[model samples]
Target chain A: MELLLTYDVSTTTPAGRNRLRRVAKLCEGYGMRVQKSVFEIVCTEPELLTLIDKVQRIIDHDEDSIRIYRVPKGSFRTVRMFGTAKPLPHDDALIL
Target chain B: MELLLTYDVSTTTPAGRNRLRRVAKLCEGYGMRVQKSVFEIVCTEPELLTLIDKVQRIIDHDEDSIRIYRVPKGSFRTVRMFGTAKPLPHDDALIL
Candidate 1:
């Protein structure tokens, strides 16, 4: 599955900044960064669960927002990009 | 349907900035802004089509990227927010 992960981590405090960095790092391990706080992760169902669990643990449930949108494989057909950043490349090259 | 709209408008030029403002204004007419470049909109299929068309016109497809994620209605149950911004309000109060 292809998952679109978007998050907003509160950075009002020192701890919040740390959390933000940590979450970004964790996401990098799972997929490529599409935007500053957005990532395109291609993984299996179990991997998705683990990713969510790890992210949920690092975030302050009261001060952060995280959403995971499950994108069907090959759904990029509906996507239109008109910028430097190309759409997710095809090929299972991203699968772990 | 509930749609999550995210976009990255290039601001390297004066024209790009104008495009950004125009696109944002168009989105405001459709739904609530969730982040700087993110919005949560509740609308029907026709409304969604209208939004895509208007946005496509305002953006420089070669320098901007727009993504519309179709979120199933009542799917907010899986959404977790831990910040000052609450989730989309219920009650179909936004239907047009």
Candidate 2:
């Protein structure tokens, strides 16, 4: 399954800044960083659990926020793009 | 339709910071800010177009990016949340 992970790690303190870096590094191991704090990951249920566990350990529950969303198949078609980033490549039909 | 807009407006320069603030302010007019730079908006196609137009004018094509994603119906069920933010309410089986 494809998952989109979005997070808001407080940076008001030095420890919070470090946690932000650690969390981003952990997620980079599993997915592509589509936005500064958003990642697009493709993995199995077990893998997802492991990633979630690591993130849980790194964040302060009362100070940070994290949300993981499952992206349904074919959702690429619903993305509309603008600006510098490449619109995610999509090729639904191509006859040879 | 429901849309999720994510943006990365360069903040290294004064003008970029201004653009970031402006872009965020504009999005706030139409939706809820879910993350530091992400918004969840519920609106019509024409409304979306107006928003897209405004955002386009504020960003620097070579330095910033913006992406709008359409949220599929029932996607709220797919959200797995953690931390300070409230898990969005899901009442799929509520009988009361």
Candidate 3:
């Protein structure tokens, strides 16, 4: 399944980059970084659950932060093109 | 850019659904739900960062449990077809 995960960083600080990089490493093979603080990961129910657990550990923010919205499978196309009128070549390659 | 986001729910409980729904509503137009607990949202840097802040407000989990990986653009196709050999039509429409 396609997943859209977005996070809010404290700042453009080294700590933030380190945190994001760590997340990238853990999500290796299962996710792709579409933006600086956004990621897309694919996995089944069990695997997805496991990854979420890992994410919780990865971002140890004391203040409640980090929001994830689970969009239905085909919804990516509409959402991706919402703001941008033209289709992006990079996203076209994301087609299954 | 394309984004894939995955989340972990406590259970298939009412609260979980409500939480997910809240997130869905907040992320409306920018994300799609590809799975029960996973979604794909597309947004720019500022928008994504803002969304993350809203997420924290929706899911008030004392224990950290949401992990987000920001995959670079064009990485979704590779990861989507990783385990499944055959391509799914639903995802195809997701192409930009």
Candidate 4:
């Protein structure tokens, strides 16, 4: 039900933003926004497939790329525990 | 020192695979291969910037998308504990 879609767009041009907008729109129907350019799409299997199809159609530019990583239903939440900016502690002692 | 580069290519064509090959080649200069299409690139900050530059040059197809996630240096190792297919346990008791 949760997916991590990480993508890159050619920030050098307007076309890139347009492509990203399409991706955002596609995600709107499925899940909540997580981080910048990362969406937490919550949906059933069939709906998620439809969302993927819609996303593929909207992303027509070769300069832009998106990867939809399906984390075994619950991994996404754990990854979020650390947030995005804080790097993990090098000492093994820091892990909970 | 570890980064997760998750990419999607149009498996429908050879161009997508070629783009991925470029990505793999780019990663070779810095780290070890972990899983299929995933690498554990180890390098200093400057080296990583250079690798990203090379990756951009080799990948020219819009049909394929790649996302390079820089883990907080330690998170990748924990994720590995779960492997790729097992879903996280719903009960917090399973977490180490």
Backbone clashes for every candidate come to: 5, 0, 28, 1
Cα lDDT of model 3 by residue, B32-74, tens digit: 6544444555677777777767777777465224444455554
lDDT of 2 by residue, B1-96 (tens): 666788876565899889888987888777667777776666678888888998999899888888777776655555677888564443232211
Pick the DockQ winner. Answer: 2
Question: TM per model?
Answer: 0.67, 0.78, 0.41, 0.44
lDDT of 3 by residue, A14-74 (tens): 7766766876666654655544445555656777777767777767465214554454564
Q: Which regions of candidate 4 deviate over 4 angstroms?
A: A80-96, B1-96
How much is the lDDT of residue B55 in candidate 1? 85
Model-by-model lDDT, in order? 0.70, 0.73, 0.52, 0.52
- Superposed on the true chain A, the predicted chain A of model 4 yields a TM-score of 0.70
> Which candidate ranks first by lDDT, i.e. highest?
2
Task: Point out where model 1 deviates above 4 Å.
Answer: A9-22, A56-63, A82-85, A93-96, B10-22, B60-62, B80-85, B90-96
Q: Largest TM-score belongs to which candidate? A: 2
lDDT of 2 at B54: 89
Give fnat for candidate 4: 0.00
Chain A fold similarity by TM-score, each prediction: 0.77, 0.77, 0.68, 0.70
Where does the lowest 10-residue lDDT sum fall in candidate 4 chain B? B87-96
Residue clash pairs of candidate 2 = none
* Ranking of candidates on lDDT, top first: 2, 1, 3, 4
- For the predicted complex of model 3, DockQ is 0.04
Q: After superposition, which runs of candidate 2 have C-alpha atoms over 4 Å from their true positions?
A: A11-14, A76-78, A87-96, B76-78, B87-96
Better of 3 and 4 by TM-score: 4
Against the correct fold, how does model 1 do in TM-score?
A: 0.67
Q: CA lDDT of B20 in candidate 3?
A: 67
Candidate 4 Cα deviation (angstroms), residue B3: 8.3
Per-residue lDDT for A21 in model 3? 80
